[model samples]
Target: MKYDSLARDIIRHVGGKENVIDVVHCVTRLRFRLKDEGKADTERLKAMDGVVTVIQSGGQYQVVIGNQVAEVYDAVLEAGGFGNAVSQEEKPEQKGGLMSRLIDIVSGLFTPVLGVLAATGMIKGLTGMLAALGILSTASGTYQLLYIIGDSMFYFLPMYLGFTAAKKFKLNEFVGMTIGACLVYPSLTAIMAGEPLFKVMEGTILQSPVHLKFLGLPVLLMRYSSSVIPVIIAVYFAARLQNRIKKILPDVVKGFLTPCITLLIIVPATFLVIGPVATWMSQIVGAVTMAIYGLSPMAAGFLLGGTWQLLVMFGLHWGMAPVGLNNLVTYGYDAVTVLKSATPIVTACVVLAVALRTKDKKMKGICWPACISSLFGVSEPSIYGVTLPLKRPFIITLLCSALGGVIMGAFQTKAFMAGGMGIFSIPSYINPETGIDGSLYGYLLAIVISGGLGFILTWFFGLSPEKKEDSASSSASDIVINSPLRGRVIPLDQVEDEAFSCGVMGMGAAVIPSEGRVHAPVDGVVTALFPTLHAIGITSDEGVEILIHIGMDTVKLNGDGFKAHAAQGDRVRKGQLLVEFDMEKIKQAGYSLTTPVIISNTPAYQAVTVLAQTGDGAGTENGAKISCEDGLLCISTC
Candidate 1:
């Protein structure tokens, strides 16, 4: 758990498990729907190691963890035990308009399976590439088998949509999958294509087919596989109907009858009405999309491409995802999302430009990975780690990408499949019947133009004034630390915190404080103080970064029982009052004040040891009193 401490820190700074309403993640960010954004320590989150940045957008508190967000998300769940939050209701006061809610819902539904979706999509693209290169014949068994593997996800997409929709709607996930399975059931599509079981009223439906009938009503049959909107709508109604059935049914029979009545009614209604209406609605959506794309493709391209990152920043990209997916299903190709190709390509180019221009050694190293990652269609690194922070570079990248989009639109570029983005998505742009068409050439041109423009724009004016490199060094010899509070000294290994006890956070010792007041143990400058006021960090004149934590997990108190007397960066003498706390308040709040005072930078020292002391330290004695002026620990420098 390299990120365990980071996860723990994230959880602590995001107002704890009690404050998190729900949490989910995408490629690079852990999007937490928090109970109170006001409780979050944004500066702490940004300054913490392993966290790239923090964003409060579209009613989500997003912690940018770069590519390792999934692992961190899992660790966060494990740390906070927020698994149940996945199916919980969104708070009414979470804020944002309908756009935010939609993004939240769409992201929740698609996020779980997007990894597999990308994998299969990439395989499909690879297969296409193989076929195009004549490495595998389209007629070969191997090609056919791999095609089956690649196409299965799209072929049975309804089931996947149903499962995700059910989870989002707070209904049984398996039940949703069952509904999805029924939608893609093999015989259903065959019957719809072959012939109707009986004929419906003439001209009622264009195809003139009714595959199945219930009682006397004609059950309209349509191909439901690969469809998104219908199954999602069906599951929505299923959840509502399931709830209603459960309410009316008796407890003993509720489990059996609720699903029985719900599915029996819902599935046919889906087939007879919901599916057909939703399918027609999809046609209307396709028509509207075609209209939009047709309304001066270059202008459409420029607007969408230029503003997409802004949408992404505000988390509004989710609103467009369904539109693009719908276009893919309805038209057998997508233009809306296909135009987004320039964004990542441009990001890679801009990062390369910055890498070349910047004198920042760390930044030069960061740009390499960010550039490569963006080329493969993951833009978080380039966006968060490089461009966005610089402000100007990000805007320039967007404009350059938008110019590429305009060219793409002018050529009428479109994609037939989804895949890993950027250059990897090229196979997706190839027209199936024609090998490579205008779409491929035009999109390639877009990438070239976008990259070229981004590089040129960024290299010229993207960077800020160079910073002086940090080159400070230090050396030291034997030095001792005194007790920070009136308490009984305890061995570091005996402390309750595993990080301190196991020497992960650093070499540390504990004190079961007898007095609530915390004092400076050495003549030092305060370096940091926790937002909760329960912890203080100091850098001694000898260059030791010492941490004085008031209590175990006292951060959860939200500063209720703690008060800071010494501000961060203030120089203080030994035994000077640094913090005052309510011991009874902490006790009443059910927190033990067995504080740990440790040298956080203990690794810098050759050895750090607690000094053996006589009795009467900080009023824990039988007869005498000793303040923080007393010695606690000793260190020998490397």
Candidate 2:
């Protein structure tokens, strides 16, 4: 509820509740499946308070809100009047290609459980660490209790996945869970462990031991506990079956009869056919992944590690998560998780180097917090705000990460369990039965070398100081955004609206207009002209984005006493008329005429300096009156 106002602002900027089809949250992001992404004001949302960044990827609009994403997500849902369940009618038509859809599906399925999954994984790793250090015996009750806390999630993973997948496939959740429970029932598991009555195709990989017969049909029994693919496949089929069966059945009995028939048919078929087929498929997936790693560990590591962050940026990393989990369940260890582990540390080091080296105070402030977040295994801030924007530092980070992956690969490092990221993940590398081992040492060495090189290389080669001539010369890249209105200047923070004053929407000065005419601040195309004629956005030829909002809450007037001089997408020169509004009318309507001129893409520049000027071009410190076309803010590219 504390974020209710922020949430309302976010929803309005994201094109309101009508634009949203579905929304969910992971550890640090609020991902929305929107009906039309173009309707969302991405730049405005990016600059909004409480948002770290905005990304449109994997067919979703993602708003990164750091660790507090869940609370914000709840706020968004409540503020938008979107209850817990999204109606089927609201589901948007699927967009994008196959890869995009796959990424969307995978993210939806796994995101719901990621927080608790990581928590339990950390507990498991801690128990392993204690046992490895001889601080606790595995036989002790304390260790046993801790192990169960950690291990139960994985042991009954199918059930948890069943519940989530059912939501995704629009099935009755209880039925999906019932299917999962049947797969791992004690009776079925007991029968699987009993002596085989017959063996089929004994010489081939398809060979199976028949533990029982159902209507003269041999049941190829296999352990379903901890398996990934079987339950999901079963649930998908169950959903399809129940839907069809319900349509023909009488309405009164449909609810009860549909579920009973669905369970009666799907559960047995899952045991006899779907379970075996899906288990084999999972094994093939794991085997193929391991075979690639086995062929040339170093090469595989270099490729995967280098592209990991890129995949993460686009949200394609979700597609890789199940593969690692499958490998852990099938082979008891995964190489994919090992190869990617060094990336966050590398990102942290790169951001740290940038923080120390940058002369820009604003850049330094952004980098320090981003570097710390990267250390905790969250790197979106570092990637989007610092390294990626700077260009060279991000490239250096990738090269360093690849080198680290090479080292890890050559040592055959393996992750025994899913755990926390960055330094917290070190315990997962500890060999359970052998205590301290080569894998742990390999992991430590990889991170150290990668992180070390990330800092050293970035500080020296990645970032260089601006040339003296470049700093002094009037280059084309340097833009001067003039005052859009003849007004008395004020600090942006003094503006009444928090969205404008908090500096989250990017830095610029506010003006209490002495005149009603608004002019183009730079030579650019009109990117946006709000229907109410109270706001305008221009993208300068030099790539500087400026937003001129006429007055506080003037939008509520709905175009009263406002006129647009130029339409959206019209090319205009600096000082050209854009809009004319009646200041007296806005004030009469109880609105503040403290208009904000913001550099919407402030992160792309080195610094945005506010200028205080007088009639004779003399500089003043406070409340200087300015004319339209006079220099307001000087943007430094260097």
RMSD (Å) of each candidate, 1 decimal: 14.4, 13.5
How many residue pairs clash per model?
A: 2, 0
Quote each prediction's TM-score. Answer: 0.47, 0.45
Q: lDDT of model 2 at residue 327?
A: 84
Per-residue alpha-carbon lDDT of candidate 1 for residues 1-638, written as tens digits (9 for 90 to 100): 66788889999999998998889764346878899999999999989988877777667887877536668887897788775344111211122456544434544465566556655655665676677666999899999998888779867877887888886776777778878888889987677677567654454322335676778777765566555556777799999988888788989998678778878988878777764454444444334444667787887788778866665543234445566788789998888766667898898999999898765455576677767667766565566556754557888988988898898999999898865456767888888888899999999999898889889888877764332222241123567777898867777677765545656556767788888999988776666665567777777766777888787656556678777776553557777898889999988877778877788777788888766566644332232333476767778775
Highest-scoring model, TM-score = 1
Candidate 2 lDDT by residue in tens digits, 1-638: 88899899989988989998988764336778899998999999988878988867657787877535657887987899775544211232233466445434544465566556555655665676667667988899999999899778756777876887787787887888888788778798778768989987677544657888888887776666656557877898988998899789999998699989999998888878864564454444334445678788887678767877765543234345567888899988887757878998999999999888765565676777667657766565566556765667888989989999899998889889886667768788888988788889889999999999999999887665422223453565576788999988888888876656766667899889999999988776676676667778787756678888888767557679898888654557878988889989988888899998888778888998887777645443456889886888989898
Best by lDDT: 2
lDDT against true structure, model 2: 0.75
**Residue 7 miss distance in model 1 (angstroms):** 24
